[model samples]
Target chain A: MKHSIHMHSLFEKLNLEDIQVEDNSTLYGQANIERIRKLTLDKVRKDRKEMSFSFKRQLCKVALVACAVLCIGGATVFAAANEGVRETISSLLGISQEKILKVGESIKNKDYKLTVLELACDSYTGIATISVEALSPKAQETFFKDNIVHKLRISPVGYGLREEAPDEYRRYFSFSFKVSKELNLYPEEGLTFSMEGISKKITIPITQTVELTELDIDIPASEGYPMSYQKLYYSDLGFTLLGSLENEDVNSENCLITIEFMDGSISKFYHYYRALEQVKSDNRISVAKTQASIGRSERSVKNDTAPSDEDTIIDFDTEWFSGGSNSINSGKVISIFSFSKEMDWSTVKSIMVNGTTVRLH
Target chain B: MEDYIIIKRLKQNKEKALEYLIERYSSYVVSIAARIGGRLLSIQDVEEIASDVFYAIWKNRGNLIETGSLKPYIAQIARNMTKTRLCHKREEEPLDEDMLVFSSEGVDELIIHKEQLQFLRDTISLLNYPDKDILLSYYFWNYKLTEIAERFDLPLSTIKSKLYRGRSELVKRFEEGGYYYEA
Candidate 1:
């Protein structure tokens, strides 16, 4: 599927207009354009702040947790040790002992597996490092297996920790995991390390800008409109479009169109239309008192056999509301009650809510 | 009769508001569905989704933080609705919130890139003659820092500084124009 899409795009790049013509099949016609526009406009109105308060609160909570943990455990350990040991541990940890102490204080009796690995700091210094490692429930089995040890190499003096720490603050440590399987990893953007227990959730906003090129769909000869292809032409307001196939016997409606010609532009017909002379001047298409089957392309069900007993009537009621002063003055207050009902099943037909009626099937 | 007044009416559960909303945004919804190439849902389906969005907004109008940022807010809602419609069509796949994460990982990158390009095009069209020329020469025309300085008859450092500030200003404009910050 991906390969075909790539090929489709390649063909598109070779000819964009043509490619777009081919692309039109993927999009539904212009029927729901107003709805999409409204929804989009509403979205812009909802979230004014780039980052909401909840997000900030969540970040703060994580920070507080880390601080509490570090203070409870990490501070005591550093305070008990000598200055040299403290310096050594700090170098191995890469972060200031204060930060570690903050994290340790928050952790209360939680079983934590600690790993101490001799590694090189970022400044090429050899350092002893202590870090937390979580062997997820699913990976514990394989991780404990007797796997081949790759190599044991450490930095000379100021190890990988020195890389993150500036030359002035050369005392730091670093540790890394060596996984056997491929892993999808995303480090904190512009930085490698993140605060402990902080969750990173990404939200993407959808955006789009489009220019409507052209509409050239052929309206088929249906019962409603019987206009010949050549006789129907458009002049700015409306027109009829037609299509032909090599096999004239094939169903024209179902035939897939190839909207490509010269200049790398491709055009496809959305639907056939027969514009009435009266409404052509308005450049608008509307259906009034029209009984149109939505999914008509499907196979028809033949009901030659007569039904024995069928009750089509659905019990319904009417709900009404008075229009405003202006609407009442305009003589538009009266709206008919269509359907308000209770049924054994969930289907409701015509529903009159307030003053408007919705046709539901 | 104004759009905002209509929105207020919708919030008040006035039936006329529904008609007004449908009349106003139905075409826009269809256009959005068309752009995304939503094959599972028809234009009518898009209308239903848009209707739901409006209904939700109406129900939660009091809770909305920024009423003025309507366009981007509605854009995000429509986008979410589009995803929901697409996901529901895949009945065999177990419904997982994480599926949205998977869909967003790579596909959104393309969308963001397209938006940025569009924003840049708009910015180019909107900038003044001198600023536009400087931007076009430095960025679009790919003129070297020294070359831009030489062409504009300014110091190389000045040219670079202006370019930097111009880029930053353009970013701020894009942000204001609803190009959301990802991080």
Candidate 2:
């Protein structure tokens, strides 16, 4: 092709500004005044008809609300208590007051609110358990003795995993009272609780924020090999447990980055969910490391000097096929710390263990 | 509410239907009419021509379809009205024939092409914040390599590399987000 000739001809083909602007003047209105009322807007909207999936899907909104209400007030709570010993305690005792339960008396009543607020639950082998950090109304002190949180039952709702429990659905619930009226309330204290007959128990402990250090990871031949990859350096590994009510893409499509905290909680940061409509989603991004690992910070990995020693490593193993197109060589490991694209030296978090996968909570 | 519906109820009347129709698509009709008018005539003259086009559509609504399409139907009305307005205003003098070549490129085809472009615009608004900004600034805004470098505060080469890689990233994300279609 004649490079200059082609360029000149292309330039003559169309005015780039006119092509860019097209007839999209309505989007950026002219310097004029106009007022549209509700009826006028609705009429115009109906005239310019278009199909919307979100609105169609929203037809099921009423059904979902009804399900939510029924699941909250039913026998689901008892299911947790009978399912396992750990769940039995967590259902009734509340984390901080786990061990402080008497036969019939409730020890830390004020702390119950805190425990409920911070409730975290996990289930294994059809049994569910919950624990939360609780503080007594009084300062540091131990006043309660070994007591039991009786009548433990958990009501398990078919929350996200509706397909998992087709045979039977169950939830959990628990309630406990001191054996005699002589037992009075202590202002501040700590304790653990378990179900009446089940071994499932929950104990709330003092919560504290701890610094994260590098956990070196060696890619076994088991996953794949890297062709050519770059390294990224990050500063601080700001870690937090994935809570239910937070800004997250836990259920986004093809999000391979899952962060597991030391406290048995899990969260995923799928970057593909952040792209625009014209972009294709790359499935090669592996989120299979289902175990608890450090989540890379989006802000810390800017293109500058490395921030600090607290940074975490995200080892992206981009193994290209031998016949793959472009410079993407098959079998390449490009490790990035945080969101930086430049290659840098680093490793994974220390909290992650080998041979065992840390699943997200 | 019923008055709005009453227009639809009286779709059989030629003049009444045309009046309601003009009131209905006035904004879109005016804007598109303005675009064509601005290029061919003065702004004030175009505005007058656009209003006249609306009046013509108002007088001619009985001939229009009830719902299948609105744009193509109105575009035809605008074109005819514009030709009439131009002939009366420019009867004594004529413009260069070459300028008319630009106008000859079927405005109707352009109108149809605009529907697809509007669909693309709607799709962009549905994207997440970061992805939407990056794609719009790079493509629609058309900042050059050095300009982007200064704006994003990065090395020129880094900006180039990022633009190359970011385009690919966006392509992948767009497909994954179910926006892009395989050829």
The candidate maximizing TM-score is 1
Q: Which candidate's DockQ is highest?
A: 1
- Provide the lowest-lDDT 10-residue window in model 1 chain A: A75-84
Model 1 DockQ, alpha carbons vs. true complex? 0.05
Q: Compose the digit string of candidate 2's lDDT tens values, residues A1-361.
A: 0011111122133322232222332321441222222233333223222211122122123223323432221111100001011223322221222322223322233433111222222111011123222244331132122111112222211111100111111222222110100111111222244333435444433222112333323212111111111111122211211111111122111112333444443333211122212123432221211122332322122221111232222222211000000011122222211210111113232222112232212
State residue B125's C-alpha deviation in candidate 2, in Å: 28
- Model 2 lDDT per residue over B40-87, tens place: 343444445555655454334334445655666667666666545533
- Cα lDDT tens digits for candidate 1, A84-201: 1112333322233332221211111122233332322111111234333333443343432311011112111111111122122122223221100011111212112222232331
List the candidate 2 regions with Cα displacement exceeding 4 Å.
A1-28, A31-361, B1-7, B10-20, B87-183
TM-score of each: 0.22, 0.18
Pick out the ten consecutive residues of candidate 2 chain A with the lowest summed lDDT. Answer: A319-328
In order, the candidates keep a fraction of the true contacts of 0.12, 0.01
Tell me the alpha-carbon RMSD of every candidate.
Answer: 33.8, 28.5
Q: What is the TM-score of chain A in candidate 2?
A: 0.17
